[model samples]
Structures are given as structure tokens and as C-alpha cells.
Target: MNMTDSEKAAKVIEALKAAEGEPAQIALPILNGLVGLVQGGGEAPLEFEEARSGAFLAICEIGKALHRGQPADQLWAPAIAAAERWQALAR
Candidate 1:
């Protein structure tokens, strides 16, 4: 089924929040959510890149949280770095 960007973002954010404080494996489902968003959109390659980078960041954040006992916001270094690169290239 198709979803608007806001819909997809909400779902993804929910999945991420639910996965918090759980095992690193909880991130796999979150990764799948990101993939779903990437798949539902139009033909814009930039969208795919942005979603992909976002997914990587999400996964990295979840993994780091599960491993290091850090908070979600604190675990976002990888995602932030990836987003910076992706945004730079998108410009």
C-alpha cells in the first residue's frame, strides 16, 4: 500500500521509539520500516538516497544504544554523519 511522507515518517519514528531499550535485533524491524518508506515513494533517486541514509542512521543508532547503554539522541553520531554527507551530495 502507498503512504504519504508524513505517514511513513510517523510509522518509522514509532518503530524506532518502540525498539528503544530493546536488543540490537530490534533495529532490524526499524530497518524494514525505512525500506518500506523508500519503496513506497515515487521515482526520485534523491528520496531513495535520503531514506537509505536515514535507515543507516537509524540502524546505527539502535545498535549503539543496545550495545552501549546510551540514549537514542546520543547514539545518532553515525546517522548524523551519514545525513551530512547525503545532504551535501543532494545539494
Candidate 2:
């Protein structure tokens, strides 16, 4: 059976907690709240999937940057450049 989005988020939370560090500290609560949003039906303000993806992307990138001893802001440079290129391309 496929896991629900909340289930997936919970799994991520479990792993993050096991990893135990700044990423866990920062991301754990966000993922905890995300579980509710996933179950929140149509009443939630933001589309939970979009919020989930963006938050996960930031967490992964920030983790990578920190692991490499680079500033967390390092992700913005490539992300912005890629976004601009994607925007300019015909859909």
C-alpha cells in the first residue's frame, strides 16, 4: 500500500530524529506540523503538497551546504539561476 503524505512526513521525522542534529532540531517541528496539514482536507490555507516539497527541498539543500561547510545561502545562487532558465524556456 502507498503511504499517505502524512505517513511519509512522519517517516522523515523519524529519520531526522534518529540523525539528531541541527537539521533534526529545525525540521522536526515543521514536519510535525506538516502531518496535520496533510490531514487537514481543503480547509488548510496553503496547498500542503507545495509547502511540503519546498520545505523538504530547503532542508536537503541546507543539509548539503552545512555538510560541505558552506553557508546555507549557497543554494540560492544555483536555484535562482535554474529557475530563471526554466522560466525563459517555452512551456
Name the top lDDT candidate: 1
Model 1: lDDT of residue 78? 52
Candidate 2's displacement at residue 67, Å, is 3.4
Residue-wise C-alpha lDDT for candidate 1, range 2-86, written one tens digit per residue? 6555455555555556655556566555555555553433455765567555656556565656566556655544544444444
**Where's the lowest-lDDT run of ten residues in candidate 2?**
82-91
Report the Cα lDDT for residue 25, model 1.
62
- TM-score, one value per model: 0.47, 0.42
Can you write out model 2's per-residue Cα lDDT over 8-63, one digit (the tens) per residue? 55554444444334453464454344333233234333445345545456445645
For residue 83, model 2's alpha carbon misses the true position, in angstroms, by: 24
Could you tell me the lDDT of residue 35 within candidate 1?
59
Residue pairs with colliding backbones in model 2 are none
